[model samples]
Target: MQQTILEARHIQKQFHDPVTVQVLTDITFSVNKGEFVSVIGKSGCGKSTLLYILSTMDTDYTGELLIDQELMTGQSDAQLAHIRNEKIGFVFQFHYLLNEFTVLRNVMLPGLKLARYSEQEVEHRALERLKMLGIEHLATKEAYRISGGEKQRVAIARALINDPHIIMGDEPTGNLDTKNSEHVFEIFHELAEVHNQTLLIVTHDQGFAERSGRIIEMEDGRIIRH
Candidate 1:
């Protein structure tokens, strides 16, 4: 049997500012270990909102989130921060690499912040991750000096530095061209197939969604299909 690594139940969210609007309604789903799941939806259909909630970045919603079989909803902010750092890795559309840092240093930042390993151990592990992404050769380069695809690969390496249980991407390929997007898709595919890394990606690209292990489609704040 496949083990579920993450589960969301009865997720509902409302936004109140100029007006009160329900962004997510009755969102419920589960992702299994090593499964690459893609969430697809039109813009403003609450895909990002749902992802934010699932990511433990937005906690003002009503629902239950179980990650690794632990109840994560209603947790204290400090608790959530720790879980976000230790258990989850996030890749946004932008690479968000610090331009002033070396590629290797950028990858090593999270591991150092976690402080689970000595500096030497963290450096070794970061190098290993960069090698896994085939970017070890660029480790000494400044982050601003690399190509866009290379930057994305470095971001992936950084995400893996802490050995997160789940990797979440918010339109990870949204800013890339066709070639770069395809490259990223292949990397994500390999992460699931070879590394057994669980991934939940929110993407507008249909081709990307179709290639994932599972696709969840949302419309008007509700999951229309899966």
Candidate 2:
């Protein structure tokens, strides 16, 4: 039996910017444990929108979203925040690390915020994540001092510090050069195959999507292929 990590049911979203525009329509999908799912689509195709909804960051949509089999449709803002911190790890294109902070500190932020463990434990976990990403040597370096590729690796380490159920990425390798992109892809691949981690990533790179465990193609606010 397969274990589902995330499920979206009959999701629909509309944006009223002077005129109503349907951004997503009836988007339904389920990502199972250890699955590396990639969502690919052209701009304005609603793939990113769907990701936001699934990540519990966008709550205006109509539908049911379940993470770890718990309904997330109507959770309070505080509750959603807790859920996000505890269950979902996010990696964006820009990395978003605070330039002034050390790489280790950046990774420890989420774990500290969650407060599930003591600060010492969080620091230990952050170092472990950095070691996993092969960047433990750079842990004390300032985030701004690292190369772009290394910064992305730090972001990945930070995402893993909390041991999230699913890691949601938005064009994680979009800003990297070919070599770095491939490196990031391989990391994600190993994470799924060896660690049984669930991942849902949105990317415009067809090659990246093709290499993932599964691909979900989107068009005109709907899933055209799964």
Candidate 3:
């Protein structure tokens, strides 16, 4: 059966930082299984906040979010963590590879903590992902040893090692140079189009955002258009 990857509706979050700050209000969107969707907006538009909410990393919100028919309204912290590790993959602007671990070990960490796959299984899978991203040659190197583009690729491989149902990336290309940014965007495109992985990316790059299957523009804590 086809899966319903994510459904987000009427989501709102307020930040009481010194004063009352309404970050997101009445934001609604849905991403189908194996779809690639981009959220584009200027800074302070609550794009990252929305991504955080959808990833189940932040539950302090008012809204309805469903993953595979599971409502996320009342899941506890532990339950949410389980759901996140097992179901969602995330990429950040900076490649958050553990500086001390080898590329291969870094990729295998998520699966290890989740215990979703055996150690050997995780190793094999991580190697496979590394190979797919053409960074297998650097798998034995420390995370800090690789080049920027290579590190981003390692980050991508790690994100995929779990075979997540959906991948949420927050400004994944914001730190890379032009060439590296294009390369990273290409990887994201392939992951969604060729590999049929559901992708929800928050990007400030207009060029990159235009390539997504659909673009949702956020403004002033609300979705302005699609």
Candidate 4:
């Protein structure tokens, strides 16, 4: 039996930009544990919109979202915030690290915020994640001082600090050069293969999508392939 990490059922979304516009329609899918799934489509195809709903960040949609089989619909803001901190890790196109903070501190922020472990434990876990990404030596340096690829790796380390059940990325490699993008892809691949991590990434990169374990293609606010 396969364990599902995240499931979206008949999810529909609309944007009331003066005139109403449907952004996503009847989006249904499930990502199983250890699965590396990619969501790909042309721009304005609602891939990012669907990811927002799946990550529990945008609640203005219809239907149900289940993480680890727990219903996410209609949850209070506070409850949802806690759930996000504890269960979902996020990576965006840009590395959003606090430039003033040290690499270690940037990674430790989420674990510290979650408050599931002591400060020492969080620090230990952050270092472990940085080490896992092979960026431990950069831990003491300021975030703004690192190279673009290093900053992105630090962002990834920060995402893993809480040992999140699923990592959702929106164009994680979109900002990287060829070498760095390949490196990031290798990291994601190893994570699924060795750590059994579940990942749902939205990207426009065709090569990246094809290399993933599965691809979910979207078109005109609907999923055309899965």
Candidate 5:
């Protein structure tokens, strides 16, 4: 049986304004190791909110979350941060690369957070990932110098540098052209199959969602039954 990499139980989240706004109600799901899952929804749905909660970034909700046989709700703030940094990789719609940093440096930035690897080791690993993704030639280039697709590939490399068991992406290909989007989606599939990384993507594109092993539809802050 495949190991469960991440799971959410009875997850509930609400936001407050002049009136209470409920975003997710009893949302729950689990991701097995190396599985590729995609959640699709319209804008204003709780897809992003669910991703944040499941990824262990936001803890304002109430419920149980487990990662690698560990209970996430009981973890201290520092412990949660370490878990996110070490075990979960995130890619956002915006590339989020530092303008002044080169592609290689951008990829290696996350490695600095973990102390075990030597600088040379970090460089070697980053280089290998870049080459594997066919982005090695752009390593020394500034962030702005790369195309939208290349920037997304570099973002994926950054995510992989942490050796994360679960990779989360929010509209990772939204801003790209059709061809670029297809390529980026292919890379995400590669991440799941080749590297055995559990992948979750939040996307408005049904095409991308359909490509995943599982598709979750979200609407009005809840997962829609298909």
Candidate 6:
């Protein structure tokens, strides 16, 4: 059997203002190593909310979150930050690139933040990732000089610079055109199949979700299918 890379047990999330609202129900799931999984649901169904919790960014929930056999829930902010920097990669709907920085520098930022490697080593790794993603030619170009698709590819390279075990994306292709979206998906597919990287993507596009190896469908703050 494949090893479980991440697990969520009985996760419950709520919010309170004048009234209490449950954003996520008892969410329990496991993602096997090298698996490409997608979480899909309508807006307000808690897919993104659950993704945030799984990313270890939202600590207000009640549950046990285990990633690579380590219990992450209830960890202190510093500890969680360490985990995020070392083990998890994230891509959002927007490319989130630094427009003023060169593509190479943007990709090197995360590695520098991790402080695990020297500046030269980080730059080397970042350039290698850009090459792998077919964006090395744009490495010296500023973010604003690249096309939208190229910018997204640069973002992916940045996410991979630290070689995180799990890559999580929230609507990563939501801003791309159909062709560009397909290109992004193909890159993710290759990463999972060839590099054995685990991926957890929350997307609204049916074609994108369907092509992923597994789909977890949520509705009304609860998982309805997997």
Ten residues in sequence with the least summed lDDT for candidate 6: 156-165
In order, the Cα lDDT scores of the candidates are 0.93, 0.95, 0.89, 0.94, 0.89, 0.94
lDDT of 2: 0.95
lDDT minimum window of 10 residues, candidate 2: 46-55
- Candidate 6 lDDT, tens digit per residue, 135-222? 8999899899999999889989988989987999999999999999999999999999999999999999999999999999999999
Model 1, stretches more than 4 Å misplaced?
Answer: none
lDDT of 3 by residue, 8-44 (tens): 8899999998998999999877788878899999999
C-alpha displacement of 56 in model 6, angstroms?
Answer: 0.7
Put down candidate 4 lDDT per residue, 116-218, tens digits, no spaces: 9999999999999999999999999999999999998999998889989999999999999999999999999999999999999999999999999999999
* Candidate 5, poorest ten consecutive residues by summed lDDT: 217-226
TM-score of each: 0.98, 0.99, 0.96, 0.99, 0.96, 0.98
Candidate 4 regions exceeding 4 Å error are none
Give the Cα RMSD of candidate 5: 1.3
lDDT of 5 by residue, 104-221 (tens): 9999988888755998899989999899899999999999998888999999999999799899999998889999899989998987888888998999888898888899888898
For model 5, what is the C-alpha lDDT against the true structure?
Answer: 0.89
